[model samples]
Target: METSTASPPANGRVHHPGLRTLVQTTRFHAEHRPDTAAVICEGRTLTYDALHRGSNRVAHALRAAGLGEGDRVAYLGKESEHYYEILFGCAKSGTVLVPVNWRLTAPEVSHILQDSGTRLLFLEDEFTQVVEGMPTAPPETVVRLSAFGTWRAEHADSEAEFEATSDTPVAQLYTSGTTGLPKGVVLAHRSFFAIRDALASEGLDWIDWRAGDIALIGIPGFHVGGLWWATQNFNAGTTVVAMRAFAARRAVDLIRDLGITTACVVPAMLRMMLTEPGVSAEDFTTLRKTVYGGSPIAEALLEESLAVLECEFAQIYGLTETGNTAVCLPPAAHVPGGPLMQAAGHPYPGVRSKVIDEQGRELPPGAVGEVCLHTPARMVEYWGLPDKTAETLVDGWIHTGDAGYVDEDGYVFIRDRIKDAVLVAGENVYPAEIENVLEAHPGVAEAVVVGAPDERWGEYVHAFVVPVSGHEPSPRDLHTFLVPRLAAFKLPARYEFIDRVPRNPSGKILRRELRDRFWNDSARKVN
Candidate 1:
């Protein structure tokens, strides 16, 4: 219950050093920098004072709606100031905020809503039809984004008395269903602040935040990267600019116009922005750093990004379960042709990493195996999946399903995936998820999906199919059928009609064999 007064830190930083929970951060900033902008989205600005009071009102509304501690309140929409308000409100009221990826299909969306056992849903005005058309029923209380202002205004803006610790769960983000159904990764308040506190103690500027820093949330809030990055800036009491949805051209304009000093983006987003018409280094004059990750970046793309951005570049690598990034390739190691450029980088302060074999024994340096990370920022657990929670997380370590090795110098090099998940433009698209829908088509007797290298997207989903005797379906026919069932990113970019799919003696489909065909010419197995 310790709090700082309205006086700013002597170092010129605006954040409260004593703030531990998300609610504390909002309250601290509201007291010190009440008039400063906490979040700016699509020309709307929410000041720190307004955000704190607004979230207080939201917390009252949630309590009045009968939601209690640990209850899930789902937000189905794009990134906005309202989203952050609800996020902090949930933190204050002890409710967990579940942000759904707006791009997902109705069925995919339905699964998350049902799986999380959400009690209330905040739907965007545009997605009302999507929710209404859903095969499954939505929550009992559904509030549209258009009516949120009025609804929230009905409640008092006074702060609520709720006891929350650093370990209190604040957000539950769903994974990409690597095993066929997305699991909610429950993250607590510490997930956003633990690593920041660790690095601050070490005097490391690896991914430093400044007083006037204006960070652009390039990634969607539904993703760990976006949510983590935004909160990181907020913890520092800096200005945050979020996009409704990532558009390359619009991002460029925001950086130039808003004087965005730093941004968190994926490699594909960098590629698109660099290739955007009329974009130049001049447009990025105010941008001091660009933190890119979520997918592997080709050497060629990294080289171009460095030359064009003309700013510090840091690469991050981790998972939703690891609370975003446990490893970081700091700006200092970003040499034009350095060997470390190929590495996934070293673990951040207070983070431990190792490569482990299939039997769970730690592997030696230079040996390829599943990468494991232990960090204070790790997620609490997978909501409602005890077996999965035990399997992936053991003894406070996350067994990342990525095949990689740690070198003698401690740099991590990721070579391939231990899991059969594909990274499409920073989105995790599991082959099984796509194969399930593809096989449902009468034209496809059997189907196997894999990731294929692409110059544009880091990797594109490719499917190999065994067509039914007389009902051979063209790629177009299957694409049309799958469009309404899956997210656009999960759809196969290319399809191969074959007599049969390769399999082993145990009848397991040789997914790697089919995937190897696409990456054989490349040096790395993964794109």
Candidate 2:
């Protein structure tokens, strides 16, 4: 059973006297299960003892490079098990790790590197152009991942002289910035483990990570969800199977072969896995739980997964600023005729959520307003954006840009982004609602809604769609399917066929990218 009354003792030297930081957690695993597998990547496996010593070398190397408490170091690479070493090492040395999205353009990547003021950068070889293309000189110290071993070998495997408290800021995750420029979210290590601590206190296991649980992580390293999920399992001493990148077929094969007991994936990954050949119910016999988020899953898709995987589904809802998940719809809440799917579930223990109006006043349960969350896991601040930070985080509550309502049962109903709302003929239309309706069409594989410039209606609903294989859905075909499901004003006034919906590294639809094309030479920037 979950017990939080006393600290779980470590096997060796007490890192912090109690389970107070990520460094301590990793140390606990290393000392307790020295030979147990900690991470599995492409043909590479790191046992707990090996990871511990490797990270110790990394910490010594960072100190040798003049990095210490509060100094920032950036990592630009795809997901890899080495990321855990860098992260844990930084945790021990009191350095901040900034994980940059390698998928970003040169300018976008450059902006973050400069904005974060990182003293050193660990860049993958493939992304060297990101620095060469920068208008200014790259950071002074840069280490290529392929040659990372050489850098680490320069220093001995010894614990750093520094120590980090629970409140120390450990990560700087940049937001996708669909609306504008991305901001660096400064998060503390304590914030990352808040949910786990709460679950332990309540004698509950949200995802039930038993003794031999194995986890598969498909999300990219840039997002908090990806890093948080990995660290959560590492904290529990469970083996994590890492992926450099996610390919649907490979993911399916790994599920069938690797005995993945728990996984953290987005809705899109689930849909893609079903499209791979030779996949069946038996392929997922070992998967006991799946935590999915990033975007809402269609009812049909969720049902198909439920029927095939037959595993516990935990639908989480949170933001980069929330550190990870603040609310979750557990497996038991998922029923045929329940309100669970419609809601984002009650706030997790130690998390408080509410809906508020423009004036920051709390709204009644049924009133639609901005969703707000007050959680221990919330980020410390938006790095270098004090004005924006104050505006977004008020009195310890994050004013989420999502427009939704809290039900009487404390469940959250997320409609769409407040910024994405289209005011057509003075009626508010949420694109997520319209997209859900279009996705219900049998021939449509994916759909996204954005408002386009219009002369008469001020703004018109435009739908960008991706069709399933061997199917080409016409505007009329989609219109016919959506006519009965959506209100007259909510129906798409125009439809455009697209190869696929553009999503960020985290699987959040890039509506701005699609919407910008239609508004390119228009009079007004926003519809």
Candidate 3:
């Protein structure tokens, strides 16, 4: 297997030795920077001192409700200061916090609640009916976000005597199960601080936080990317700005008015902001750095972002299983036409990566294989799914299930998910390769490629293209454009024009949703 691991710097020293656990970090900041804004959302500002006290009240409330260590306490709401309060409260009280995606259907939400054995649920007022309509009974105790303040006020603000170690499970985030029910990925307190502790002495600014920096959490807290980014900034004692829901126009205004210096988002969000009306470079002057990931970005979109945002761009790659980011494409490597532009970036310090072939043998550099990562921030397990956990987390390495290769210089390049590869006449074709080419077309705004069962080739490429506003490129025009760029077998065999591509809350293209339409009656999903 091709492996890449970096050694720590010779002069490395622990930056925050006392802040090993999330509970300790919250306490440390409260004692050191009590008056600083911990989180700002919807005109509400939560100071570090208030955050600590509020969380303590939550801890008391949870204990009063008879919940104990390792109990699951779920939060089903949008981004808010109160969410963070409950997050830390769970950290302090030893109950595992499960942040449910608010966009999920009633059945989906019920499955998560039942799977996690959630005894209490904290939800927004709008979703009250959703929970009530679930096929299965909802959690026994429900606390509405509207009444959170009053409920929390009933408990004392004194510190909880319960103490948790770094290894204690603090959060359990569910993955978007495209094929089946989502699995709960249990994360420990150390998952939030592993990379930071490892890179403390390296002085690499790939994804750094600083004092007075206002960081925007563009992605929702339900996703690992958002949760990890928020904690990273909080650990550095920086102010965090969260949006109840991400809106392109409102995000621009936040950057301009709040002077947001750092932000984390997905590629789709960046494209939306750039295409929003009346947005200009002046609106992003305060944005010094932007970290993007969740999906591969089109070269054209990256070029536009570089020109318009005029800020440093870093791309991160990882799964919820790896604590959000185990690899980073630093800002310095974001050249438009550079060779490394297509790379996923090198593994972070203290993280190790390798590529393995189908036979489970190590592949040489530049050989396409399944990418696997060994990170200190890796999740403890897929809650209650021992068989799934054993299959994924083997020998302390997470089999990413992504088809990729590691270059000689340790740069990783991801093609696409292995299962998403379209087999055209026995030749493997990754949808990302075709999708990238289609997205680069001036007439195409976005594209999603999936395999359609065919009698001749076993399966053929079918693309769902979202055309650029006011531009319509026909099938022949697209075929002509792709002929010179892609292999004959890799070219799309069919095209369907659409207004928008469907995506999950985390901004990942839901190819399964589209692929299922063509495969529902098929004898086999793949030939």
Please report the candidate that would top lDDT against the real structure: 3
| Candidate 2 deviant stretches above 4 angstroms | 1-17, 522-527
Worst 10 residues of 1 by lDDT: 5-14
Indicate the residue-level lDDT of 301 in model 3: 93
Name the candidate, 2 or 3, with the larger lDDT value. 3
lDDT of 3 at 480: 97
User: Which prediction has the highest TM-score against the true structure?
Assistant: 3
lDDT of 1 by residue, 1-527 (tens): 54643223454434355888898888878887899999999999999999999999999999999998999999999889999999999998999999998877888889999999999999998898779888999999999999999999999999877868999999999986533678999999999988887767676777878788899998888888999999998888899999999899999999999999999998768867987889999999999889988866666668888999999999999999999999999999999789798789999878999999878999999987789999999999999999999999999999998888899988888865666678889876767557757876867767888998988999999899988779999989999999998999999999999887764221236577787778879998677
Total colliding residue pairs, candidate 1:
0
TM-score of each: 0.80, 0.94, 0.96
For residue 204, model 3's alpha carbon misses the true position, in angstroms, by 0.9
lDDT of 3 at 385: 99
**Worst 10 contiguous positions by lDDT, candidate 3:** 1-10
Arranged by lDDT with the best first, the candidates are 3, 1, 2
Root-mean-square deviation of each candidate, in angstroms?
A: 11.1, 3.4, 4.2
**Model 2 over residues 213-295: C-alpha lDDT tens digits?**
78999888788888888988787778999899888888878878888888999999999898778789999999989999988
Task: Tell me the number of clashing residue pairs for each predicted model.
Answer: 0, 0, 1
The order by descending TM-score is 3, 2, 1
- Model 2: colliding residue pairs: none
